[model samples]
Target: MCTYESSSCQTGETVVIGENNPVGSGNKGKRFCPQLVGTSESFFIPVNIPSSFSLVARNIPTDQTKIRSFDCILRINEAEAGVQSTFFNESYILCESKEYMYADDLLQNNVSVSVQWNGQHYIDDPTDTYVTLYKCSVNGGSCSRCLSPEATPSFLNCGWCGTECNVIESDVCQSNRFVNQNETNLCSAPAITDVRLSHNYFF
Candidate 1:
């Protein structure tokens, strides 16, 4: 459901890997339903995070019918980060989150994210993707040499391990920092409202 445009049939082209369906049980008689042929109108799922608890939607492909392939990604502010996916049916789920979606206390005082009055400083993990995330709002300068794509992964801040910043601000690191680590404020602090998810993309 990620990019529904009737693109290709690569997902269906395969030999019987296991004995789930009937025809696939016999070799040379492998069941092949790889190509999902159709025009897909992506659904708009909304995920508004209310204070108290965070919500995660696992194995989202199960909820969708006629699903050929599906994937879900995470984002900070609006910058896109790396995404995970599943082909046909695998052990992994279609959609998943890190952790800590909401809390009544998070709605009132300083949240898991560092925050001051300056408006959501460079503190990391505004969305609380994991238990411990670092926020570092720095200009995209020699970042690959300074950070880890997994620790602070983003198109704007992603690279091989130990590769510092190599691009400009708009093309790379901007004003926000989202490190999936222990609470380490690389920049300053920023007040956060409830962490939010777009239901239009979820349920």
Candidate 2:
């Protein structure tokens, strides 16, 4: 005697069903049903770093029937960095960390992000859950290293100028010295240009 609507069943959407026989139908006979969705993909980003940054996860499925809290764990170089709990009602989650992570600390650029629902279910893929860390400014590093394909992944937008690596629009490097990731040849060029002297003198 239970009737359920199939067309109304949608992800994150709920519908109620009850018996229509009418002999002894009570409130307890009604069932609350919630549509659960599976997480297809999830990814996070370091919105800001070295001071205060928000770890944001996108496209994460949510179950409203479960607890409203979830845990987000961050791992750097295969070591656990920290974990923070976040509250969300939708498919998006964010956790903010004030810990300072220097460029030297993330030189390896190996980071992993994962999330758990009420300490019960993990919602992200295990095999392809690595996040690429981007740091263009490192101590004692040359411009070539900053603009190299190996050093600067396609996702990072940075350029080299003089002795510093900055965002492409930062204008830190002069016209002739500015080299971006697109200029592959400039990565191999010498950082300093040589000037031939006509005469030699003692300082």
Candidate 3:
């Protein structure tokens, strides 16, 4: 039961599935499940979940035998959630769509529910297993900028200029050229380090 905190989630936590399948030598058949330990802030769940919230399960291979089968059940508080089984591979459980919720009350009270794998497994690995979890973006859809702090978190307005507004304009360079509107014979160029105009005008 390891707990952590990220920039977006305060209750980011992880649990090792090795306790269930502790038969193999080394990290052959182990799974890891990451879940939000607390509900201090709004966290993200995989958009791959079937409903606005549903339990998804995937059997990822962790050993050579690939005899990995478990009666894994997901619970949120006290209510049993619908567990949808997808695919199982030799490397690990591929229950990409099946996820376990923490509790039913938590899901009902909150817009989103934090999930965790708290069920017993048939095969217990000698070591530990890790389950992969994908976080959602600020929009609760995709994970475009969920992991990166420097990336733009939400949609940004580009204004009428569009992509041009995203670019930073360099200093203007003065050139000795003729102007159509003004007879000053001075022109301004883009991205010039120095100015060499004979006359300068303030506009």
**What is candidate 1's lDDT per residue for 76-117, written digit by digit as tens?**
334333223332242223333332122222211122222111
lDDT, candidate 3, 1-203, per-residue tens: 23222233233222333555554343222344422223223323432233222223333323334223323333334564434234333332333345433322221122322222333333333222222223222221212222122342222211111111110111110121112211212222225689787686888
Q: Tens digits of per-residue lDDT for model 2 on 1-203?
A: 11235354565443343466444233332233211233443332322342222334443445555455566666764566545554444434555443424245443364666666666656544344544455566521776777776875545566777677755444454444767778757665564668787687888
TM-score of every candidate: 0.19, 0.43, 0.23
**Given candidate 2, what's the lDDT at residue 60?**
43
Q: List the lowest-lDDT window of 10 residues for candidate 2.
A: 27-36
In candidate 1, which residue ranges exceed 4 Å CA deviation?
Answer: 1-59, 62-65, 87-132, 135-203
Native-to-model Cα distance after best TM-score fit, residue 197 in candidate 1, in Å: 55
The C-alpha RMSD of each candidate to the native structure, in angstroms, is 20.6, 11.4, 19.3
Worst 10 residues of 1 by lDDT: 114-123
Quantify all predictions' global Cα lDDT against the true fold: 0.29, 0.50, 0.29
- The per-residue C-alpha lDDT of model 1 at residue 105 equals 20
